[model samples]
Target chain A: MATAADITHIACVVYPGYDALDLAGALEPLTMLSSNVPFQFYVVGPSLEPVTTKVNASVVKTVSPSFGQSIAPTHTYDNPPEKIDFLIIPGGMMFLDPIERQQPTIDFVKKTYPKVKYVLSVCTGSVILAQAGILDGKRATSNKACWAWVMENCPNVNWVAKARWVVDGNVWTTSGVAAGMDGMFAWITQIYGEAAATVAANVIEYDRHTDASWDPFSDAWRTTDPDHGKSVQPKFTE
Target chain B: MATAADITHIACVVYPGYDALDLAGALEPLTMLSSNVPFQFYVVGPSLEPVTTKVNASVVKTVSPSFGQSIAPTHTYDNPPEKIDFLIIPGGMMFLDPIERQQPTIDFVKKTYPKVKYVLSVCTGSVILAQAGILDGKRATSNKACWAWVMENCPNVNWVAKARWVVDGNVWTTSGVAAGMDGMFAWITQIYGEAAATVAANVIEYDRHTDASWDPFSDAWRTTDPDHGKSVQPKFTE
Candidate 1:
């Protein structure tokens, strides 16, 4: 049994305009694993300040006085822990705006990926990892709703069209927001055992999709082959 | 189509030691309804301070800095908006510690429920509503893991065993944390028709369980009759 000494440190990267479900979907299941396996988590960002999501100001303003206040990072990218066992990145529509706008997040992922045991991305979060060259020569998937944009931006990645999640070596990528929960459940199964994963799912009453190849969205969205699409010129600035 | 003039204000009652997914699971689906229905949200609590969850502190402390920060509430119970269209209450293990411990939360729901169009509870959140007398004579459900405790505390309410969610008039209650997403999806369907709910579910990539009667967990957990069990004396103090 893993003890406190064997605790793994997992980092969840957050940013302004990130999807709240993308973060919560993954964290909820992962946190439930704590009772079985000793592990810790870190919400890392550019700074320790609060980051807002894209949930529209007027709707969330009453609850979150400023922007759509989502989460406040515990550690700045500049001062992360010396060792991180796992890293999770969540997605949002903001990534589709301008690739150059994600430089800070890109830089942080690039600097930290080598030190982590596993790197995971949810929805458009794969875009940041792709921009950092972390998903190069790796199998990955992103939010199917924005599949064309992801394929256009990161041509080097083996982007799977019909997949709930894709795992290549130490990298894990998932489709859309809620899919992250399924990916996290699968990841927990990989780390611990199926029993541990089942317990976690039961705790949250989540009917997890265990099969990575199971994705009905690709058919729903009619995602085409990456090669057949007219690729938008990569606009990411190093 | 609902315009800005027809916007509904939904207040999510939050507290310290609340379950993070209980809030997020419901909010994620409901927030997606905003673009279609023109609705707003408010995270109301005792104060505007950061509230933590049951997620192990060691895991989140590095990311949140203090008290394993989860979310910061927008409005206080003492000063909420003039009118609220809906109310949501999320549940956690803390509620099981002592029913009286949740006096403040119960009071808030009781005071605000009459003005809202609907009241929703996720996981053990049903306990709070039940304690508040909002669920009196109303059919409801709660987190299956804590089924016995919830049944014991809120015997006055008609508790259903096999249910993904229950809707008695305008009050909605769901079993467990992730079940809240299903409940919210159903609630959206009630407000804006199935088409709008489908769009919201598609956006989040959520395969919503539409049937309120579809609950497999009750069979798995071996839940018995709510009336069959010897009721524990209500511990909640007025």
Candidate 2:
């Protein structure tokens, strides 16, 4: 059992054009867990330089001319900590770009996944995990707005269309940006118990969606892709 | 009417021990508005040094012994831009501290409020606005968890308990951390129109609380202060 004294190190993977909310929403609840569970959060990127998001480009331009909010990473992929208990990856417009363009991030995820205790992805972050071949045979989900895109690109995973969050073994994936909070709260509940999760949510006054299956977004944003209902066989069925 | 060419510069006030969600939740939706409306966001702090939050102390300690996630502020209070169109203030645990302790931030609020066209506050951020004498004759709301503390401290403002967000002229205030998203969405609707607001919410897959009067948290965390019901007369009642 993890006690208050046992520190859990969570590495939040960030990159340029990443969705700020995907990382922020998940961090909000996770941060609230600090009082009961001693933990650390490291904003890891490809480098220690300031990273930009998809939003506030004009503001970000003033500071870095290239990045958005000027978030300085504590550690780079090359200099990550020896141990990472939790790995969180957030998605953004960059997710739609070619996989080769994000080779460094995908490589980091592949190298780090086996050592981490748990893996979590927000929005299209699952796409990155899929590209890394981690979610090969896992049941996962992605942002509802981009569900069809994921279904078309990753044909090796059993992607569920109706779920706020899908937890297959140690890997957890959420739907869209705000849904990351629900997934993080649910993940906390699994690790820290319902009481701890409840306390964390209460601190932020967040009415967390406790039900993993209660996702209304999948239907709200209907994907016309005929393959949307098709279940792709897992390549690594364990 | 504001066009895409009309830029709105938003100065987000941040500090050590600040609530990550208060600023993040608001920024998520506001940032989404950038594609349709040109806006710039500046993370302002006392200096360019990293600001710490209450959570993930161990991880934050690894990077900087003094702060949590290292947020590199683009501008300082002293070196702020000449024109700030919008002002955003977020709250955290240290909100209840003596006003004298945060004199610089309070002083900045007092000095900047008049120049900004819109002033938005999240959670106990209203306390800072109140302390700055900006909410003197205006209506506002804050995090229900710290409702009594705010009421006791800022007795000169007309504080509304049953509101997710309160809009008095150009100033907007939200209930808690997550509620800032709702407030930002509402603010967008007011400025950019319903279609724009809807697009922003849909992108995040966020089901925003559209009604300003739709807050149940105020009752859930009700305070027993006798002066809770007393509506303080606004000192700058227009």
Candidate 3:
């Protein structure tokens, strides 16, 4: 059974080189849930200005719109909803502007993590979380293409090598670009029950990756560098 | 091999209640392909103003951001590029503002279809193409959740019941929201090469649904209304 009253305001953080696609998968399911659940989500950036998003980590991170899609933000980190039940952070910044250059957004995540009911990181988004000292001891997963880089950068965090997504208490982390959808659905199933998740997935014709351990990218792409967008693809046995 | 000069400019149309999610799946592969292929995609609208996007057609079309995500457009129909190599139309208008009310966009599609090298429609975007008199006597597919309504409205189109996507010459039409990704990848394979498509899919960690006729949503969701976002889900056994 799902209770709408407890968790209502959801804030999705958008940043330079943010992968809007990572959030889209979760948004589709959440949007359907909002109908009956009354939960509302908004895009939040460092400022209210428009931000261009990218996910092709292999390519050079150019500010040009030709590289990605531009999105408008309704809320900023300095001025967000009074109560945020869920906070979602997407990856791409690490590949573009490195963790050290992303101080403001990182600081915001650190400060707000304690207040939010739950937090989710997609791909290298977990690296930002790890930098913020949030996933210090938590078992999390990240983009497999840059497995060594992520592990090397975050030594304190227990990075799971094989997982479509990981759930360690209130924190949820996913692998690569598309795995965020599987994680979000799994999170939704846990919070709103299996029925709600099923309906959300079916409505969008999304084949939900039910098993969390159903990940082969970590093993297959362990040696592959994130710079090589051209690689052999791994399939999920649905 | 995909030549860099052939089809370079792609225009993605975004409208009221447009599903950015549908485009996200397509863009991921296309973005990767753009590296060497030189094909660039841009978001376009009826006007320069920001447009809110939605895919949960079950909900009422609200202009408010609470109901959907807002995306900024780089170009408009009245003033578009000198040449558009590929035209990508996304669905959501048919579910929100009816085709008759979407005169500007519908007219744009009708006028641009013949000029472009190739045209692609995602989900109910096919319905828009059908409304523009482009799908007449052509094989196509649409959102299975609203199959009856689409069929009733567009009687001339040869709608396939069990197809992930349908390609008739230069025009490609997909099944539902997420099916567009599968279709776009297939289209990529056809235009570029199997190797390029495979790399793009793998880079994004997207499991490519290769079969053209591997569509179960059409059969399973024949009776489900678009309004009913909750229903039984269909899956593809990998």
Candidate 4:
């Protein structure tokens, strides 16, 4: 059993229009991990200001060197510290913009990945990685919603589908918001062993269904139908 | 089906030691709601400044305006111009402290309850409501882990057990963090009807068991304990 102190550094990226769950799902386990282990987490953004979520409820606070603020495991902290041991990128609506324009985020990712062994992404975060040329030929997945967009636009990448997670050596990616937890669990399992990961998932009552090694690199990726027309509320309510 | 503009106003409270799920769970449904419907959602704290979550996530870019920020929801640009149509008080680690201070939250709840038709609380947020004297002798439930605390500290409340959600008259409360989704679903069910709520819940893939009208005052609440910690996980390392 690992105590909370084992997780010393984790850095998360936040940008405007970020999906709340992608970040939250990745965090739930970490918060539990912190209770049993001692670690420092950071929410790094472009500026030392608040980044509004897509839903507008939760905000990711910036952590500047001069202004110190304390946010609990389940909350967002102000500007995070610069150095980190593990870095995670949770996707949102604006995840795939050209990295050239998103200099701050790309610079942060590029600078941190060489040092951090466990680098991860959720949903379209893989798109950002793709733009960064990090997953140029590696297998990965994003928000299944962006399946077509990624396949057509980012040809250098081998996009996986139906797979909850895609791991090629050290780099990892998840399918969507909910799947981020599964991906992170897999990462935790790799480092701490299965028992610890299972215990962590059990504590949060999360059920890991999709297989970790199942890569969707074939027809399986194309055969699935999109989750469109799922909204029941009439488009034009009478 | 709903456009971003369909929502007239939405506000989620931020305070110290607030439960992440209590906020995220409720926001999830509303997030989905916004995707389908047009609406404006805002995160408002007791003050206009940034409020940190219990999990150390800071919600930033917030304007901490007072109730007097605007007399009419239509007039206010920072927050709801008039009475908030939908308001959620997320359960946080800092519930009793606010009550003891008789801070703005207490006055806000008491003064606004008469106008706000739907007043929602997730997990221990109900404790805040109870402390505000709104749930006095009223059947409600807090986080199952904190049931004893709620009962012992807030004697005016009629604490219920073995129930995931409890609703009496206009007030709604949930058992724990995740159960906040159930409360939101039920609330959506009332506003849009079961067909809409059912469709919305299915879209989000929420595994909710209880329904509205499963009042905490009834014996049905005593049938089983969902939080008995029966959570299990895979032990295999492969």
Q: Per-residue lDDT tens digits of candidate 1, residues B19-115? A: 8888888988666655444555677888877666743343343222222336767788999867787788999765336667678999999998878
Instruction: Note the clash tally of each candidate.
Output: 2, 2, 0, 46
lDDT of 3 by residue, B1-238 (tens): 2243568788888887777777777677777676566556677788878877753344453322375678888889888777888889877636544567567888888988888888899988898899899999999988876676677789999988778899987889988878888999998888877987876665566776899988766656753345333453322110
Model 4: residues >4 Å from true position, as ranges? A1-6, A54-80, A95-103, A189-238, B1-7, B54-81, B95-103, B193-238
Runs of candidate 1 exceeding 4 Å displacement: A1-7, A55-69, A225-238, B1-7, B55-69, B225-238
Candidates ranked by TM-score = 3, 1, 2, 4
Q: Model 4 over residues A1-238: C-alpha lDDT tens digits? A: 2223344677777765556667766766665555444556667777655565532222211211111112222222234465567778877644233434445676667766777756799877787777777888899877654566656556899876567789886788987666677788877776766876755554343545447644332223342445322421112121
Q: Write the per-residue lDDT of candidate 3 for residues A8-90, one digit (tens) a residue.
A: 88888887777767877667777767657666777888888777785435445332347577778888889977788888988
DockQ of predicted model 1: 0.31
Taking all chains together, each candidate's TM-score versus the true structure is 0.88, 0.86, 0.89, 0.72
- Model 2 TM-score? 0.86
Alpha-carbon shift of residue B42 in model 2 (angstroms):
2.1
The residue pairs that clash in candidate 3, if any, are none
> What does candidate 2 score in Cα RMSD to the true structure?
6.9
> Lowest summed-lDDT stretch of 10 residues in model 2 chain B?
B229-238
Provide the lDDT at A223 for model 2.
41
